[model samples]
Target: MSLKPSSRDWQRAIADARQGLSAWHVWNLLAMTDIRQRYKRSRVGPFWITLSMAAFVGGIGLVYSTLFKQDIRTYLPYLAVNYVVWTLIQGIIMDATGVFSSSGVYLRQEAMPKTLFAMRLIMRNLIMFAHNIIIIPLVFLLFGVWPDWEMLLAIPGMIMLLVAAYPVVMLIGMISTRFRDTPVIIQNVLQIAFFLTPIMWKVDQLGAAAPFVVGLNPFAIFLRIVAEPMNGRAPSLWTWGVAILVIVLLYAITGPLFARLRARIVYWL
Candidate 1:
């Protein structure tokens, strides 16, 4: 057996991605079913996710505003957007760790494209994201943040995020399958990152070192690309450059790794 992925493997992987994209009806049905199962018999159902986010944003935003001595008006909205985007990012990575492992029954039984699971994960989080994001407009309305055309810029940033998410989840999920400990390590790292990134705290508070901090954090980079636009500030050219470059590099890595591992992933389960 050869260790290297050949041209055929690359082609097959591309075909898998295409099939996954085309299997929209299947994955959307699967994703919605997962959501239904999770919230089964609940009164508010998925609105619990929205309410939970509202609680965190309201509670933490108020306290952190006092702690940081920032104005409540600006701070709350900032926190709302950052936390919402972060939740989507966080959810995707955490779910990715088990995207395949948890779907062992489905994968083992059907001749399904593995990318379909990845799509299902993305769809699931996006649905949750929709539920959570209503807090942003509510916070904005209370804080007097009227939306303008600039907010439309965030649409592209969101597009970039979705673009980055597929490879991010696929790569992480593959690695997590090979090494079971990856999920725990990732959880710890995300906790550390929550503190390290400028979610609750503004980056400018770091004084002269803010650039260096955000520059090094991929999370911060993606966060700024989306959250900044939503906050009515365009992300700097540096951020756009870094974000695009990160996607390019991420795809370059995920493509080959996934091609090699796609077939073996089911076996790992």
Candidate 2:
């Protein structure tokens, strides 16, 4: 006997999520609700992420700073900012893989636009990321490191980064749902990519290899454009150009394909 419903039941959830997006309020609420659910029943709420992050940077910063013979105060701020941005980058890329995976049951039981779940995944990370950012000002205060006026550049830079991340998030989330093994593969690869990128150190430390690194690694390029300006240095205009170009191209390429395949996504899961 066939188990699939005729039509109406399957369509309702998708319609609800879509209609909910109309006001932007429901979409934001869905995203916020997901964030809250992540901390539910936890004694510390979301502070766990913050506290763990603090310990991570402090412990590692002290060890590495001492080993490298760099002063703890200076190194701490660098590590803090780097870790914070890297946390956002790594978290989004890693969590995005399962945006669809985690939402599979929801999709099967309800008819939400599928994209709403993906957006919610992004939003959830964005919120925790904000919490984690508290690490930065603390580092600045402890270090007395005064950034150049370039620090103001973070406002626009971050806006650009978030806009740029959408394509990566959408493309990965959709594909990972279709291929059950994808999330695992991405996780393994990203772990390697993280070490290779300059999350814990300055890319310039690579010396002659820095240019080649930037040319070949989109993740590094993204991090550089977004983080450099805040560190009191302006990234090369060419790098920003390339980052934005890649973002626009990826979004254009993935946008329609996602819409076309959005329905089939449910079956794949």
Candidate 3:
């Protein structure tokens, strides 16, 4: 015979799990502290990362634009924006994988919500993304890529992406806590995904196969959602619909698991 958690026990666990949102200030502060400490002695601080990314994007854009025979005016801006967005997505997924183990000290010392740690990780990455994004406007100016009203849509697209990130962080964070090797696996997969995604390449270049390659690729879908707006066009309805559908499915699967295993995280750590 086996015993299951009673309804009240489950309810309490869920409530406790959701409490992380209310503790946003705690996670936000912790994330800021991490940024400060990471660059404590450095003169340039986090902007060093921004400079590095700028150099990378510039170098890659020059080479790829030449190789692909694309106009520098068009290709450089496209590459710059897409690369920044990809970095944000990649960083979130990679960092989320270590959220629990990295916060083990706090988890052991207190009864705080596990999701708080995940939020901190996401917040840290968001801060980094913000810094790295400064180059986009410079690229825009260099390439004469001006934004229009459609650019406003990028705001919602970004919000949707961040909203989608929460469930992904929770799902990966939970699995990583248990498996330990999950982070390594996720990193390897992301490497493969990078090439498959249309970051340095254009979708139309693939011709007839573009639909299957770009449409089926979630990262591509995500890239289009944010990138199209910056390019002065609203993403197709299909893009928004697919993005929302994927997020809904992700939450449906991960939400229950998070609720069920929210307490087991401490032991796993």
Q: Model 2, 73-173: lDDT tens per residue?
A: 77788888878888888888888888777777878998766667656767778889889988888878777877688787777778877877766777888
What TM-score number comes out for model 2?
0.87
lDDT of each: 0.92, 0.77, 0.88
**Mind giving the per-residue lDDT tens digits that candidate 3 earns over 52-110?**
99999989988999999999899988888899999999999999898989899999999
Task: Please identify model 1 stretches exceeding 4 Å from their true place.
Answer: 1-3
- lDDT of residue 208 for candidate 2: 95
Q: In model 3, which runs have C-alpha deviations exceeding 4 angstroms?
A: 1-6
Give the residue spans of candidate 2 off by over 4 A: 1-23
> Best candidate, TM-score-wise?
1
- Cα RMSD of all models vs. native, in order, equals 1.1, 5.1, 1.9
lDDT of 3 at 222: 85
Q: State residue 153's C-alpha deviation in candidate 1, in Å.
A: 1.0
Query: What TM-score number comes out for model 1?
Result: 0.97
Clashing pairs in 2: 13-111, 13-112, 14-111, 14-112
Measured by lDDT, the strongest candidate is 1
